[model samples]
Target: MVSVAEDVAIVAFEQTPSHAHFNDSEPAMIMPCVNSVIEQVGMDRHDIDFTIAGSCDYLSGMPFAFVMNIDAVGAWPPVYESHVEMDGAWALFEGFVRLQSGDIDTVLVSGSGKCSPGSYREGFSLQTDPYVHAPIGLDPRTQAGFQAQALIAAGKATERDFAEVVARSHANAKDNPYAQLSGDLSVDELLAEPYVQQPLRRLDCPPTSDGAAAMIIARADKARELCDNPVWIRAIDHRIDSHHPTLRDLTDSPSVRIAADRVGLHDGPVDIAELTVTYSPEEIILRDALGLNGETSVNPSGGPLTGSPFMAVGLTRVIELARAIRNGDGGRGVAHASSGPALQQNLLCVLEGDG
Candidate 1:
């Protein structure tokens, strides 16, 4: 196992339902989750040593949009706070690192996004290299399509496998109260559906969603006192591959492999893995990269395919994994999150129960 300088564990977590349109302000969407996590830990707002949030102003369609979200976590009493332009998962990463310095005992990490007011395809396209992909209007769906085609060409996966991923996700989502989509579906029926982007059917894509998530983590001593069952964070690591899609192999995820190894994903048994399979084909690539087999239950909460809330989706992966471990669903687990085009960047976190 990867050695850590200090013991850290997640004491509490909460998330809003994945909504197509939250019909409220971003702060309104975030406040409840923030309140719930604090309540879960029975801690006062001022008790949290640090607060960090992740969001995108472009997605919110306003400059300084994230500044307004601070209201959700409460800014009164002048608490120490920070923000990340990326996902809430990255904010969690920072919090995890800060706690290791032995200066902080508790931290709150959160992320939220509302995609109803903006064009995700157009907005996300700007994340691509301006001179090359952006001007050409190359968007994420098309990028995913390219990746799926590469998997087929490399003989790593087939369209049927993509269907199976979606089918399983929908089936498993039936048990997740926070999931936006859930139902039993057959792979054969899913494969018959028309494609949204060539080779990727509509079901293959994650629905555009608006949601928020928050989690409170603390050092070993504080965590033991705060909660009877804290999910210990064993190791965490993130890695990135070439940004330019052409320069990397799309059939496999090198970044995931690196992060998984660094986090010691296989040093012990993994009972469950919440992978960020934003696209159906991603499950295939990630499954192989992480070396997860049928014995390891993957995406028991249905993962991003059934409920993707953009900036918060990655953090939600961690929440799902932690919840499973806390509830005795597993003894150990690994959570995965990805950002950028075609899974260019990956983050992995390993967690274990008190058992």
Candidate 2:
């Protein structure tokens, strides 16, 4: 339970519009966001004390693919940098930890992905255990279908409930310019649609998207100098559970609950929560696990169900939370991210405006 030596806050954030095909390289997709955040704080690439990115090479069907993305952040001056194969939310976790050392005043964190070029079903199969699941080609959506089915069997939720979640997500997305899917739809209409997987329909899933997001975190001292409204990072905690889907209780997300506790989620009132609801059913599990009440605005920006860009989706959750706090939508909020099948791993970040 170590803590950061100095307070850190998100001073600026930026992201590219989610697109099915970006018509650009990963570096090109990431550069504008990187530039936007840096410009927001009136800093140059070299001015960033440390830079880290989160992305998956498997999506691009290549190794060391993240190396090329450094061009987006620039390397001419040789800055301290690193990369993670997970979502950018995890990269943000590292940046938060690095800032805790009190040696660096600023860090740039980013995540990006393009899912249009390859079969996500095939690409994601590699994440499964090679001996057991990979050989059988178990993908994320199929795993989610199992989770949705479990929720039904456990009587925790119903197909109508899934449709309702999708309906609400679309309604919320209408106002989100970055959202790829939006508009009003009825729950009955959604339920009548054919199922992509039993208990899950086409609308129950996130859109296949290509996108990138970046943010700047500054130490408390530097934060006051960086921006007028700095969304303070109150706490961040991430936990993982059994990776094998069969070993988990798909009806619940224990990792999320644990991370929430570690971050003191129940210690205060959460005004908003931006959850990574890639699968509509996930919202149910997350809401219950996080102990969120109806008063807590959930996914006001439509969440990943509107536009999911794989590695970038998790980080976008963090961006959304910061945006809410900055825009006077809320005073305090939580951002949640999940990786692996059926919420195998979860990260929770708590943020607050100036108190």
Query: TM-scores of the models, in the given order?
Result: 0.98, 0.98
Residue-level lDDT tens digits of model 2 in 1-355: 3365789999999988889789979999999999899999998778889999999999976789999999998878799999999999999999999999998899999999999998888898889899999999999999999999999999999999998899898899899989999999999999899988887999898888999999999999899999888999989999998979998999998889889888888888899999999999999999999999978999999999999999999999999889888889999999999888878899999999986
Candidate 1 structure quality by residue, lDDT tens digits, 124-169: 8999999988999889989999999999999888999999999999
Q: Model 2 residue 129 lDDT? A: 92
Model 2 residue 74 CA deviation (Å) reads 1.0
The lDDT values for all models are 0.93, 0.92
Going through the candidates in the order shown, the clash numbers are: 0, 0
Cα error of candidate 1 at position 254, Å: 1.0
| Cα distance off (Å), candidate 2, residue 221 | 0.4
Query: What residue pairs are clashing in model 1?
Result: none
lDDT of 1 at 260: 86
lDDT, residue 278, candidate 1: 94
CA shift at 54, candidate 1, in angstroms? 0.8
